[model samples]
Target: MATAYWKGANTKTGGGFWSSGHTPTLIAAFLYFDLAFMVWVLLGPLAPAISKALALTPAEKGFMVATPTLAGALLRVVNGLLVDRIGPKRSGAISQLIVIGGLLSAYLLGVDSFGGTIALGVILGFAGASFAIALPLASRWYPPDHQGKAMGVAGMGNSGTVLASLFAPGLAKLFGWNTVLGLACIPLAIVFVIYMAMAKDAPGRPAPKSLSEYLHPLKSADAWWLMGFYSVTFGGFVGLAASLPIYFTDRFGLTPITAGYCTAACVFAGSLVRPIGGALADSIGGIKMLIGVFIVAALALAAVSIAPTVGSALAFFVVAMLALGVGNGSVFQLVPQRFGAEIGVMTGLVGMAGGIGGFYLASSLGLAKQWTGSFAPGFLIFAALALVALVSVFVVKSQWRRSWGAAEGVRI
Candidate 1:
């Protein structure tokens, strides 16, 4: 059955992208991913109000937002394991329930302290871990030829962050940030129903691996390289997603709602381009797309460090986000090509790396602000990391092309 689906779905000519896979599952993945991402980064949009309410220090505000990223990064490995063992649909269902319950509980209990916010952030990590499940759930239904588009459609769920940025602040302004948490549950519950009804496990899942065997991919250097590259691209993209509101508010004295609007514009630019990035990678080669991604991201981040005006900084951020977003899609385009057999776990590992990158950037910016009285040092340092990633990808491209890239019969 799975073989027939695979062969039929490998539509290189007339069938087209939408016809190449299970559309219902793909749509379910996107919806799941979108809502999960909305709540996952919810703290970021609410950070200004939370900080003001709690009288949080700059570093505290940074850590409050960064906590979810770090926790999510770690949880992705666990979710990855679950996806392989129980299937992506089950994994996603379980994760969504946890997030909804956590948010509901937080809303009922009320978060009044910095510590309370950190706790809520940890709960939000499950939403962040949705990346591990949603991607594989959709990717497994499609063939190698359509990996980029399949993954891009599913992965585009990150656009949910834009939704949060757009609405959370305004809702908080009207009803208080704590109430915003409870209100978020309404849409989450609705999506939960839709996801349960729509999502289905793809057939022919790999036989469950032993615990030790699940970690087998780490033995290969290629896995590490992919993880490192994602940490920069996804890391930069998500890190900025969580921190931009704080940046706009602190630097420009914009109201929280206004800052969220600015953040939404930046995030929307990045989120909007992810599918294009994947498609570009599919056509040209993932390695080639990444080379350009790193260069543009690095330049934009460095430029952002010195932008003296809000308009200039927003412009730089949007450019940086666009590059990083494309890099996100390009990285995933290579993942299934190189690690198809282990896509579930690889998604977990790679997604974790991205989350850690976000954690680092979000936290470091806060520390930089507290210690140096400016966010410049943190931005410059991350910009340097992007360059390092660029050099590293360049160093490995030749060998990749000669090895797996050739074997896979896909543009790398």
Candidate 2:
């Protein structure tokens, strides 16, 4: 197979599918992942509405929202390895089909019973696995020099949470939650078809490694460090995305619609700005970007911990979430710099860690709210973790700079 590369003016070089530049493929991949993410996070924004109808307790509500995240986190490693073996395009399409099935099943299950909702939540997690496929797909399309931007663009699909938060509640109100869930299938179906028809695997890629080679990164200290960084960054972003609606409604006396919109706004800022964060890291340095984001995130989370009013709390939450989003992009930028060759396996592992982080944060918030009747403890705990992450990054900065051989990393 011939590799695709840019040609001189007026020249068409290669016959490979990506010879025209990767923008279209990137966009298609983004849409596919975005729809998956939207479905994966549907329960969070829909939780308040479903709970009102079901009279669910706080702990049950948290479990309902967090189950998909937990499932997704666990499934990412499986999807990542599948992508490496079958190629990203095929893996992504298959994931989307699975997501469509999950959504349809969730719709059929309805919101009548807690057990039904939990079952659906677990199934929807397959949407979360789309992360493994989309990120690697975009990364493979561009050369290593352009990976920050490519991955950033693909990652912007995480903004899909914004769409779910913004619309799912209102749609549920108008047509019922089950109908809203069923409607989600429309977008997924369309994206799945388009991706299948137009997308192609990256050309001239090497054959996948043996299972042992793929798993070897697990034994490396750097892999664990990257996992920690991702757990804080991407994990925080996802956790907040899954919990914000419940937090707003329970703590502030807001209506489900209002809470959903607020949650959507928070997700929007984080998701849309993620690419910019990657670009910034590319131009400056990933270490500097990570340090700055972590500091701001800690301060913001601390402010939320002490906020006297709902408005102040919301403001702090928004800021903290945005910083976490940027940190998500920056951490991945650094990951490739330090471990480019091991990206597939490392992505699976680190992505899993991030997913677990999200699950813990969301569940912990629920537990705190249930036991103490306040989210302050949860906020403070995450703030402390952010501070530790900040110090850890600074401590490792010199080593990363020497090993990566770039003054600064690539800006997305």
Candidate 3:
């Protein structure tokens, strides 16, 4: 199919188009991913207002924020498979349309009831699954040597949370939360149309994997290890991004606007730094970057646990987000090196792990607040988990190095 497309393009344009990079394709994919991410994280900015209005318990509040993440995780595998069957361009446009519908439905339902909020959250998660399609779409368009930068650029769409964190609360405050949600649909609708018009699958690539080949990676230990690493890195980044506004409001008595600003800073720092992280990984190696990121993240989380004032809390949050962002880049760096051919399936599994981790982190914070009347325990727990991940990374590093070298030498 890709060969056919390439031939068609060559015949039409006399080969000039083939020499140009796929910049338009990359841009369209990035926009699609960004919109999905914004919707995926809607609950974070709205949590304080929604919880207070509904009189929700802390655990309930946590679950409300986590529902979309859980749903998104489960949908990633389905989306990954669908991308091959339908192509990223079609899948992205359709997914965005679905997200627009979901946002509209949530706006109409009005987040007044616990069940209603959870249902809305599930719809938002469907939007988040767009990641499975967007990342691979961008990667396939680039040459192998450029995959890291391409993926990094495309993955920056995750920064969409920064916009949500920065503005959603203010919007909700100005127009009422429901109206703000209804407004989100406008962008989704526009982006959906633009993506459909511009995005296309890469030309001259192999057909997508067979069902059996796609399933084969599931039995590999390396795949699961990568998932575990991502669960700690990308997972931590997303979980914290989605939960920060609520955490600030609950712990510091901050207003919704103030909380949104703080969360925005954290998310923006992480998202903007992702490309840098990828570049650093290319230079210094993924294992070293992962080691440093884990250490920094653990210390930052511990610092947050003991932070006594809003300034101190914000400082720790920024540091933690930076570390997690770097770790996210390192994890993906190692992923393609280890699972090049199985990229789609492995992305689904690893992406799901990250989503599940976000769900766990959000729920745990809520549980700690409700059960113990403090968030310190939750912070400590996350720090401890980072420590475990650090150890796991070290244990796997030597094995991966040897295996990768042997495989490359054999290919040569």
Candidate 4:
């Protein structure tokens, strides 16, 4: 029954959002992206149980969770290229198979050591790279006027992290962390089958570009700026998503399940706001919305660094996540406006930066806890990065206004 709705998405096109684009592909992209993300950050929610079983050190836990983010960051570039060359539907199919196989193998073999977890993380990176595939698959189907909302809805799949936070720890506690890996494959396989059935490449995909042509977006300073901006917005969001469980367990002495619940609240807030952010950016302007995002994010993170109680910390984290979540939407809203032609690769490039940012934050928090006996420094430094993004966006606004005419209801 569900399959029929998706199979029929092509016939629904008419006038507005539903009519203007392929709803089936958009829904497929979201489900694929959502499930991939759930497992991509799966290690984070499982970290407490994994750490306890392995007797891992603080730094080891951080590195373990962070490995997927770094691997995902690098693979996104590869997926971006694949999307342009082979089409997003095929690219997504291949990625899904890799992830499912990787998890199934990990489950069958069992991961007992730090090294094994690291290997598993690299496999999860394939899931993370789904970012590059999912966005373009949906984005190409929509007209420019609907880019923000369309991308926002598709991109909202990042909310999958909330699912991990909500479930993994309890499952790990029940069946053991290793079993959790195998269990994850069930949903992933289900989504993969649905994705294959529902996802269709949009018409008029760009001809395969030379490798150099794909990298051309890198030559532009605007591209660099966008990458940097996303690094902070998405970086903060995902970094905390992966790290907060560890933080709660370590700092607050919360049970793993409780920590997971707390982390879910934080992730859910960030995910929920993502589409609203894009819509707001469309109404105002990406630049204007981003400027406010950076300011709020900076303040919130700074406050979090000094939060003394779990309640206070949760409040600060929620505020920071909200600002960062909105920033994620706003960044993409601008990405299509400026680089619509290169959206495929640009998504990879900017997404890579965001992943790198997540890697740094997640890893550094562990290092900070190990070295300084507090996670405060890591939070402070990232708070500083948010301020830097604020400045970068402010400086570029005038240039963007001069270059991009007021067209398509997308404010620069």
Candidate 5:
């Protein structure tokens, strides 16, 4: 009965593109996420320009990009609570309003100092929290059989970074960087109206969870495993998205526009392939897919850390981002499989872990460059972490396949 309510049609897992779930909400979720993601990673491509204006150090630049990630991490959990309590519609609207106000303030006041930029990053963190709100908003509307496709379509909004890397610098070039914030508000406002009109709460949402109920999952080992794996996949994906502009500029002496172009190309590899990853995971097992993802990402990150010549670096990042993007989808495939009833809470927890991973990588890259005169150390460390996650996955695979995962109808 619950499944029938979630699946409005004869939609099956391999059905046509629009074969499953609430199409209107999925579209709204993606739009909301796409715009939210742009603002979330805004400071990354703009970091070089802002650093020039503020005279910030490498470490300062890193924090400038990382602050939003960390703030967003914390906010994801809060947004999760709000989703269960006030519902995704209200929570998303409020979060969007706060982010809109922040952008408006940045545009009108003009960020003059490093501190001001940091404050803006904090505001941008709310945009990052869109992950928690938007995923559940889309996921609850779909049946388990088609969860991957629905979530992937919504999750592809992570590609919002591509839009940021491609256009923000150009817009900044035409109008002052600060004014870019005001301009950002235009698109955000438009999405806000559209999302409000189109999106709705699903019929089969779980009861609003109490704090203890939400926290209870933390007691389980599987929860931690999902968190660790996501930290690497999503963390690495977004951290790179935010920090690549700085790396390109500092390493190759590219203009902000050029850096943005390269970043956009690499991120496009990630964004476009996410749905493919989800579909693939649906076809194969998520764990089997993730092992390969971590291996590719580890190798690619290692190559990029060398800060090779322009061509080699771009190629390496292109592969690295693609692997990480697939990993992001693969991890979510398991999330609903492992924690179906607690999907909202688990999304927040796992998503926050991913944000924290991004925060660490982004900041560490800045610090690594500052301390060693190269980004190699940070890349090496994360590569090792990826390897660790690989080993951890190997350890958990049997346990998961033998337990609750066995009951999950979709591939696990």
Candidate 6:
């Protein structure tokens, strides 16, 4: 019975007030994550434009789009170390500067060919590393009961990708893609100034730990589980965000602007639902919420795999992305519960997994299209993995309730 599975799961422990003091850090983290996400996923909407300019084949397009995701995965570990050592504020500023420099170099110097775009994508990975910096930055300020709400608010910065999808193609049409890249640096520069001036590391933050201690969470099985779970949720959300422009254009013969609009709608659905997901998890249980999320997402993916109409396919994608967004929120809500002491490091480790998952999905869709001339196989494969997550959650939930959920001041 559902009741049996969720026994003691509804239990709440400590209650934390959302006083006005925590607002700036939360807003700063959101801005950092949002603008970074905008820049991180820029290549997706720009892929069609760059492909036309550079004469990139389908596989080349996929590789270019997926490069940032994979590169971000590797850089996340390094940023995680910096976040642990130098603090999120400093680490984040350094990362923002690197990303800004890279963008300026690309804009002024120019990307003349496919290889240049790939190199540019690598620099864009710094934007993606904001994931490692922002979550821990926000998590440190709030208490456990407010963990879900706070992280969810920060994670909404992912809606930045929506801005990219909405505007990148049109601006590229009007001003040239290079100019768009140059213009992107402006918002980032402003954000960096704001973030530096406003965001601060928590007082009484733990002393910098050794490399081994920073990675100690990896020694736990639960850490691996969280990584796996986030790999799917965040992976699906971002992978689709990066790929949907191409998918809409290829599948439906839509223009880049129209496709961007479609992609933006889907991204908006996912981004808008995230905070609701976190709040829901806070009330019932993340374990239970994730179970529903995996199931809904798997079903949605499977349905989209065979969808015959543009409207039908998009409808499924909206549902799947919504579920994935909820899953992203639920996973983090549980993270602070199990590893509050290690949230900084865990955010990077788990965030790396999410980036890797996104890389795989984005690349696989291209490969699937190149090799098989259809995207159904990729959707089917991921649906199977979602089911794997669903089953894994069933086994893990009972144990979590009896252990972490039973703790006096932690919400499971």
Highest-TM-score candidate: 1
Cα distance off (Å), candidate 6, residue 412: 1.9
lDDT of each: 0.92, 0.80, 0.80, 0.90, 0.89, 0.87
Poorest stretch of ten by lDDT in candidate 3:
1-10
Candidate 1 colliding pairs, count: 1
lDDT of 1 at 133: 99
Local lDDT at 95 for model 5: 98
RMSD of each: 2.1, 4.0, 4.1, 4.4, 2.1, 4.6
Model 1: per-residue Cα lDDT over 1-412, one tens digit each: 0122233324343357887778999999999999999999999999999999899999999999999999999999999999999999989999999999999999999998988999999999999999999999999888877788889889999899999999999999999999999999999999989999999888777789998888888988899999999999999999999999999999889999999999999999999999899999989999999999999999999999999999999999999999999999999999998888888899999999999999999999999999999999999999999999999998999999998888867888
Q: Which residue pairs overlap in candidate 3's backbone? A: none
For candidate 5, write residues 261-359 as lDDT tens digits: 999999999988887788788789789989999999999988887755999999999999999999998898788777767777788899999999999
lDDT of 4 by residue, 32-132 (tens): 99999999999999999999999999999999999999999999999999998998999999999999899999999999899999999999999999999
Better of 2 and 5 by lDDT: 5
lDDT of 6 by residue, 1-412 (tens): 0011111221232444356225788889999999999999999999889889999878888889999998888788888888878889999999999999999999999998989999999999999989989988877777667778888999999899999999999999999988899999999999999998889877656668888898988888899999999999999999999999999898888999999999999999999888888888888889889999999999999999999988999999999999999999999989878876777788888999999999988999888989999888888898988999999998898888887778734556
Using all chains and alpha carbons, the TM-scores for the candidates as numbered come to: 0.97, 0.92, 0.92, 0.96, 0.96, 0.95
Which lDDT value does model 3 have at 204?
54
State the TM-score for model 2.
0.92
Error of 6 at 117 (Å): 1.3
Model 4 clash pairs?
14-19
Ranking by lDDT: 1, 4, 5, 6, 2, 3
